[model samples]
Target: MRDAGESPLLVAADTFRAAAIEQLETWASRLDIPIVSGRPDGDPAAVVFDAINAANARGNSTVIADTAGRLHTKGHLMDELGKIVRVTGRAREGAPDEVLLVLDGTAGQNAIQQARQFTKDANVTGLVITKLDGTAKGGAVFAIVHELGLPVKYLGVGEKADDLVPMDARAFVDALLPRAA
Candidate 1:
């Protein structure tokens, strides 16, 4: 984002998970980006709402919130995601321009099922498949795009921030199915 001349404010809203806030704080510090965080076990929605306000006040162009990892089977968690979206709208109309759901590349068919629920509940506009550097060939990537019809916006190839690269459909397909010699 810096290279693009856009300022981003990271929100540590994954309060339910241990060290989630610290992890984001470390990233924010390393990237020299600003961040807003709530107290441990506090409301994730509130954290995001505050982050938006902070970003506006600080002249940040975007607010990227890392919400708690949730399962489709958990109704309450899904409800919480909806609440966050509603609160975000209340914070600023048409805010959260994009909601990207990050999925585990190694999850295989299970990733599709999770994407379905996330898209329905959070209105996910795109997907980010992580851990592609592992043994997982990301065979499920096609299934996810076919099943959810949402674009795969990015791929997480490694641990560094730079590892998250924009998706190249042809390249990704080529990697999944290399041509015979």
Candidate 2:
């Protein structure tokens, strides 16, 4: 937000929000990114990036309700994708260092693809893939990193707080798709 000036909020999802909410609040108190969001009652990501920018501009941020998206038409899809790009950085007022975008890759294939798109279109600098126990294709990780041009910053190995781990590409390759030798 160019005009955003000193007012910038961090709108985050609910899955791992509890984990980051405190962090955002503490930082917002410092950087002034208003703690306007609690939990997305709906699919906050579905509202398109335009709405995100507008809401953050009005206040620090807003809790996008949980719900479905309207993307049956190509035009709608284009508009949605374009709007997300606008909010993330491409359309940032200054440089879009205000909000923190997060996506959880614990759902399914569609979710992984969605996360990939989020990274591709928005300012997604990292990813958090959850529930990756002893057996997971994780090929999806490579696909996401390479396809989205972003990094898998963290991985959710289990359903606990300590389960979260910073992603190490070399280690991941060695464990999942190591050398044939």
- In terms of TM-score, the best-performing candidate is 1
Query: For candidate 2, which ten residues in a row score worst on lDDT?
Result: 63-72
**Per-structure clash totals for the candidates:** 0, 9
Best by lDDT: 1
* lDDT value, candidate 1, whole model: 0.91
lDDT of 1 by residue, 1-181 (tens): 7889999999999999999999999999989998898879999999999889888888999999999999989999999999999899989899779999999999998888898898899999999999999888888878878877889999999999899999999998888889999
Alpha carbon lDDT of each predicted model: 0.91, 0.50
Clashing pairs in 1: none
Q: After best superposition, candidate 1 residue 112: deviation in angstroms?
A: 0.8
Q: How close is every model to the real structure, measured as TM-score? A: 0.97, 0.46
Model 2, span 1-181: residue lDDT tens: 3244534445443322345545545655765444444444433343334445566567643332211233223455535544544544443455444222334444445655565455544455666666676466466666666676666667777765457678877887777776877
lDDT of 2 at 41: 47
Q: Which stretches of candidate 1 lie over 4 Å from their true place?
A: none
Cα RMSDs, all models: 0.9, 8.4
